[model samples]
Target: MTEDSSQAEHVAGTEHASVADRAAGGKAARAQTPLNSHRGWSPAEDRPDPVALLEEQNLTRVPDLVPVRHGRMMASPFTFYRGGAKIMATDLKDTPRAGLIVQLCGDAHLSNFGVFASPERNLLFDLNDFDETLPGPFEYDVLRMTASFTIAARNNGFSSSDIREVTLEAVRSYREAMIQFSGMRTLDIWYARMSEQELLAAMDMARANQKGKAARKASKALEKNALKNAAKARSRDSMQALAKLAEFVDGHYRIISQPPIVIPVRELAETFGLTAEETEAAVRDQLKAYRQTLQDDRRRLLERFDVVDVAHKVVGVGSVGNRAFIVLLQGRDEQDPLFLQVKEATASVLEDHLPKSIFEQPGERVVQGQRMMQAASDIFLGWTRGMQADRYLYWRQLRDMKGSVVVEAMVPMGMTFYAHACGWTLARAHARSGDPIAIAAYLGGSDKFDRAVTDFAHRYADQNDADYQAFLDAVRTGRLVARGGV
Candidate 1:
């Protein structure tokens, strides 16, 4: 592989280059070339089918990752391919692109953005998950983000013109924010972010003035669930909300009671070289890993808390077939429980387009990159490896004041609020990992990039529909082997 090419199979000195990077890197560097011009590989032997890729894995290797009985729940053909992150990534791998390889939220669907509580007890909002975040052409993120916007608009019965306006607004905000950052001092851009006070005050002004339908909608929503509500949710209601999903396995969902989620903790003990009585030691090791993930100051405060209950719980569609666990900690009292998530690590879809790290662990890139990108991130956010056969990252809280707007429930203003939120957070994320000023300068004082993404979004939405149909065809023809054990 060409040493200069980011995703060239990571060969040290091989001649084979990634299909996208074979270009001498001039026009692409100038951001003048169309990104999709590099169709990486469309080999006939590559299957070109997402379902096939999902079927090829042993499902049991990362048993915690897979849904317990998805096949049966997915009885209808339409929902069968739901939450298939790897499948989606594999399909995209059929075509790779070139240009500025900032880290991407590989599957940047509109629904993935949300609000969650930070360790400082503030209700901070940003991109809520990064299971698929990795470095690749920034365009992939734009493409994915816009595609989700259109898909969401269509689902909400918006006219084409209205949908276009909403999505164009999203891209415009991102482009403009990047430009704004470019003119700032380097360190200013480094620390630049949309603060909670900034958001709350803006909503207050919007509410007082009735700026527009979108702003009014957002103000009303925020007013209904203000900081007081957030505080209650983070501290008082989090465990109850999590327990809502649990069942009475002999009174409660304890390790010995639940088979799968609890079963793995024992395996964790064995994998980490600890005995049954050395429970504190094993848990302490995981806490260390979690601490190292936080920014220095936050780690010190975490050192004081005593971990209370830890459990394995199934979570998320794209991550259904991956390992996910939660650890609850009590600092001063039982009321102060902090929940942390440890998700499995897997190869990135952008792996074929990003630089190889000396670190062999797969998901470290995602967890670290996510923290870097997010303006205000979960302090409990961190990663660990060697315990669950493969590596994984640990992050805090499942539903500690964490919430997302339902696509169907979105009104026009809600869409605008969501779009603006995405734009602001995306710019912040890009700033954290790359030269945001350069990106800002590239996008200065124009809607050209915004319009380009809207155009690309329209075209790619059609492509997603086609891909969705392709998935349906695979199911109809019995090409996709499934256990149907929902």
Candidate 2:
């Protein structure tokens, strides 16, 4: 595909150009990069002080939020504060040497990895969530991932030494793996994946105490159907959501409507300068985009469901402020329904660092990126442009079987297995989109680079903790309002 193949499929665009040639061919396309997209912010002043930018953007305090999973504790504002990619190094300003950085899942924490069914009916596990996903220095993903381990360990009340050890373990794994990726035959890295049994055995061998037990338990569970059967998977996905929708109090999902759901912010039409008719039409318009994004089967599937109700539901820690909504459409039969999540795709943080990104549309990057990184992706994954809005990307079904390992729960032994899985998944993802041979070759036959990065990770993790605290201080001291997901 030519560097211009955003217009075509993922085939090598215009024959495989060297990195330099590809960069030059991609120059005109850089407009898609978020760093260059928004011109209003004063770069000279703001870019220098990410700390100040955090305050200025009012990114410090967060609001109350719920976990997408059932039975997990409600994530605190502190959790969001830590989860926010805003804190991830604005750019890879300073770091150790890694030959090249690919398009990274910028905020790739352990929790962000999961298994999802692809449109082709493959159930592949990789980076499952991409809200903060953007193309930037690969180290940014590393730093963020390592820091998350630190924070998670802290939350779990692990000792400083334990945190340090786990942090080192995770970073060491990535660094070593990347070096391995650097030297691989290209095909090897592309085909890499961690078998559950292999991983469980590794965890047992590492035997970090309780972590090992957890890994053993997870192993038993995964073995039943690590790859879910379609009938059961689809039925399970459909049933739980349909059950919840019945109790929705005007766009709010309630198992039985025990508490009033957060009414769509738009219910107060005054704020949006619209009347009831206009608001109704706006919801319909959102659904229209949803309708256009479906597959032939999905379209046919939706034929059973008419638009019953629509409401903008806020989602995620980093994405809390963006325009996100849920369209509740029901089939002719009361039990049949579909939930489509319409999330506003804004400029990505990786835009600046990703060449050829300039000319691409931001919303398109989201869909395109998700497809590239995820081995298996949601069938509903599709994008649409809107007249009233800049452009809105629609992909439905975020919460089905979307369970994940709580990073904080990783026991010592499980930490080892967890690190291996994350490394294997991340390596596979890079191999999918990049030249993994050079990456694997770079580290050929040694864990030296991994050890170095692990050291760097510990030091950088300290910086992240400091940064996280600074944010909390900014909010508490009234520098930022600390909006949504409190």
Q: Compare the candidates by lDDT and give the number of the best one.
A: 1
The C-alpha RMSD of each candidate to the native structure, in angstroms, is: 6.8, 7.9
Estimate, for each residue in 288-375, the C-alpha lDDT of model 1 and write its tens digit: 8767767788788877777655555656555655666766665675445556666776766556434554346665666766766676
TM-scores of all candidate predictions against the true structure: 0.75, 0.73
lDDT of the structure predicted as candidate 2: 0.54
> Relative to the unseen true structure, what is the C-alpha lDDT of residue 204 in candidate 1, on a scale of 0 to 100?
74
Q: What is the C-alpha lDDT of each candidate?
A: 0.59, 0.54
* TM-score between candidate 2 and the true structure: 0.73
